[model samples]
Target: MNFEAAKTLCRSFPGVTEDTKWGNDIVFSVGDKMFAVTNLGEATGMSFKVEDERFLELTDRPGIIPAPYLARAKWVYVEDAKALGDAEAAELLRRSYELVFGKLTKKLQREIGGA
Candidate 1:
């Protein structure tokens, strides 16, 4: 998927907020915790949290790698937007949102109507 499509998919999730961080990266967060990030200048790469079990499996694929700086937290970077189909991209993004959301405090989840 392209950057716009990825941005739109992230925005569709409940309680997601988008902001520019680190000068050029676009971050998507739920309850103040980031779930996804993409570069502003190019669609060269995008990063999102993945299930711990899937991290190694995903990184083994071409065009995908363990995210720099955040790899220990089980984030994966897609080096090529076209590496994944639209449906798969959407699913991974949604899962990223869910993973982050699940970690938020219950009170915050209630405030976001995400509990």
Candidate 2:
């Protein structure tokens, strides 16, 4: 998905927050923990968490690679924003949001109404 679409999808999730980080990156977070990130500069790429089991499989795909500095955590960076179809991109992003949200404390989850 492109940056605008990604932004919209991420903001639709419960308790999601958007912020500009590192001057050229846009980050999407839930309960203060990031789940997605995209570039604000010339590059067209997006990164988000993925299930551990799917990391290697995803990174092996063309236009997709292990996210820099976050590969150990199973995040994948989509080098081409349109590499995955819209539906697939949406699904991955939703999964990323769920994974991060699941890590939040129960109380925080409840406070965010995402439990």
Candidate 3:
């Protein structure tokens, strides 16, 4: 997908906020934990977290690859957006957001929900 579409998808997740963390990277997070990021200048690839088993399965797919430095942390890169349709990409991003959101402490969740 194009950069704007990617950004929009990232922001569609609940409690997700976008910020420019690393120089050119746009990061999407729930609280302070990142779930996805992309280079602002080039839409070369996007990074998103996945469970270990799923990460392995995805990276083994033809057009997917391990994220550069974060591969060991179970992040995967979608080399070409067309490999997975928009719906699939949205699902992957949603799952990544949920994975990070699910890890938040109960207190944090309540705070985020304005408890």
Candidate 4:
């Protein structure tokens, strides 16, 4: 999946936003909290959260590694964004969105709901 595709999928979720930060990095957020990021200049790049169990499983694969500064938080960096396939990548993005969205306060969720 390319960054453009990723950004399109990410923005499909409620209360989602995107921005270019740290120069060339594309950051995706929900409720103002980041859930995924990728370096635009990199040939193949995407960093996203996964379940802790999958974290151990994924990092064992080639072209995948603990994301810099966010590994401990269960984020994995995909050297080739398409490594996971388009459908799988979309699923992961939704899961990441749900995980981050679920953490928001009830009030915030309600407000978002109203929006």
- Choose the strongest candidate by TM-score: 1
Please give, for residues 1-115, the per-residue lDDT of candidate 2 as tens digits.
6666877899899999989999999899999999999977554889999999989888998999999999999999998765788788899999999999999999999999943
Which is the winner by TM-score between candidate 1 and candidate 3? 1
Residues 32-76, candidate 1, lDDT per residue (tens digit)? Answer: 999999988665689999999989888988889899999999999
Give the runs in model 3 whose Cα sits over 4 Å from its true position.
Answer: 1-3
Would you estimate the TM-scores of all the predictions? Answer: 0.93, 0.92, 0.87, 0.89
Q: Write the per-residue lDDT of candidate 4 for residues 4-108, one digit (tens) a residue.
A: 687678878888788889988888898888899976654368899888889988898887889999999999998866467778888988998888888999998
Model 3 TM-score (2 dp): 0.87
lDDT of 4 at 91: 91
lDDT, residue 51, candidate 1? 95
What root-mean-square deviation over C-alphas does model 1 reach? 1.6
Query: Candidate 4: where are CA atoms >4 Å away?
Result: 41-43
At residue 88, candidate 4 shows an lDDT of: 80
After the best TM-score superposition of candidate 2, give how far the Cα of residue 85 lies from its true spot, in angstroms.
Answer: 0.6
Select the stronger candidate by TM-score from 2 and 4.
2
Clashing pairs in 2: none
